[model samples]
Target: MTGNTLGLDKILNALFTPYKERVPDVNKITQAMVAKGLINDDSEILNDHIAFRTLGVPHLGIASFEKIFLHYGYKKKSSYVFDKKKLDAFWYEPPYSHYPRIFLSELRVSDLSKQAQNIISKYTSSIITDPVDAIDLNDYEKVGSFFYKPLWKLPSKEDYLLLLKESEYAAWVIYNRYYLNHYTISVHELPGQYSKLENFNTFLESIGITLNTSGGIVKTSKDGLLKQSSSVAKIIKAKFANDEEHMISGSYVEFAERLVLPEFKSIPKKKLTKEHRRDGFESANADKIFESTYLEQTTKNIN
Candidate 1:
């Protein structure tokens, strides 16, 4: 898909197109959010990060999916493990200061039950080689197209539910392979009333967006620097193997607002600086946000 190196903004717009098509609320909510904050245009709002889920098997994992972002000048930042959820993730930093960070997580297939493992392996086994290794990293369009490309066949409806019972994340990636799980909005960049997550959340609720409250309406870090919230996934009709169709939960969009660390308060308001603003993903906050796609949460909020 690449003829020459494309600009970062162009790449992002192309990447977000399909996601916005599926979750129309993103465009609506974002536009309204900027208006509430009294921002003159949508360009003023900053995105914190975008996250994706993958199956940790032979040909598909962070190692395979991460090449696209890495080719776009993103570097690995931190690693996190969710033992209870059987998941591992890492956040990547961008080459430019203005670009959004990338957070990626993969389900540990080996940790699942025998039946679940077999179901997962049955599909990914076809990918005998690492696909990312074959991509031309210098080709931006080629790398961008790789994000939506399907590496394996669809899962059977019966096998899908079985995996869901044991691992919600696993079921998600199995069906929604290479889809953008969520895009985070940097609310810290908003104006006065909407600068804090608490207020911004209230604004979101007023507009009829149901958020993931697994941890709480607002999830905060121990230090109170990072706060996150996500709308429940919008369930849409998905066609599985054997031509069976059912309405299943798809991806959701996430909103995050970061605050300056206590020590950084010494700087003047105008002089506080971008360095003062909190950066990176919080393991605690992210852990709960991941529940946005759980069956229990999406069942009530099908859209």
Candidate 2:
């Protein structure tokens, strides 16, 4: 979505490759959409945005992770704080309208209990410099590989469980550093019947997709202009530092619908464009959407 179109494509491919493998729901949902004529191919579905989770520590977190996208012409936008969840996040606007927006969030390590902080710091403390700063951002291959690179040694299972008991977000970063947390699909871009989230959610459920039911099936903004839903993260068996293995929550896929802004409501349906629709995310909606990776949602019994 910038002058470096070819470069961005390569980098995005790198990020999505592993995410797709880890989150099979992605291919499952996309393939189902194809059967229902929702899209011709994978590329037709608009990626509303992609999210990243980080540990808020020196030389890491948003300040460092964002450098990659920002270098590709993504501009930082709104800031959000989740007091209860102990998170701080910002959404970035893409250089071109076609590019997916970026959502970057960090666990507020200082807000956690002393014990929890120590668990996270054990691994992250060794990052003495912003690793992104050392790389040539212009080198697409290097930048692409950076997302999957481990910033520090893996944490022991005991440390991971201790962190999980305090903050699930912390435990995730300790193992899944810089991994693409979730990528969203713009449901508003689907066919008329499936363009609405409620209808789309039904379609999702029909294919055996378990949705995150934190606040409700549909997480709506106060203004009701933006609505979102996400799949419960799949449980992946992880082999920890000491050869201990356990099934843990992994990345998920999200679906979003952005209604036409009140000011642009009069635009003809046939002529409507993204510029005519509501933009950006809603904190209240996001607050619940974050639960996709949470244990309650992921471990909820499917009916």
lDDT leader: 2
The lowest-lDDT stretch of 10 consecutive residues in candidate 2 is 1-10
Question: How well is each residue in 1-303 modelled by candidate 2, as lDDT tens digits?
Answer: 333978898999999998998899999999999999999999998999999999889999899888889889899999999999999999999888888999999989999999998887888787888899999888999999999998899789999898888888888889998899999999998888999999999999999999999999899998889999999998888989979998788999999999999988888888988889888889999999988988999887334
Clashing pairs in 2: none
Q: Candidate 2, which segments miss by more than 4 Å at Cα? A: 1-3, 301-303
Instruction: Give me the runs in candidate 1 sitting further than 4 Å from their true place.
Output: 1-7, 34-37
Clashes of each: 0, 0
- Candidate number achieving the greatest TM-score relative to the actual structure: 2
In Å, residue 7's CA in model 1 sits off its true spot by 4.2
Question: Using alpha carbons, what is the TM-score of model 2?
Answer: 0.97
lDDT of each: 0.83, 0.90
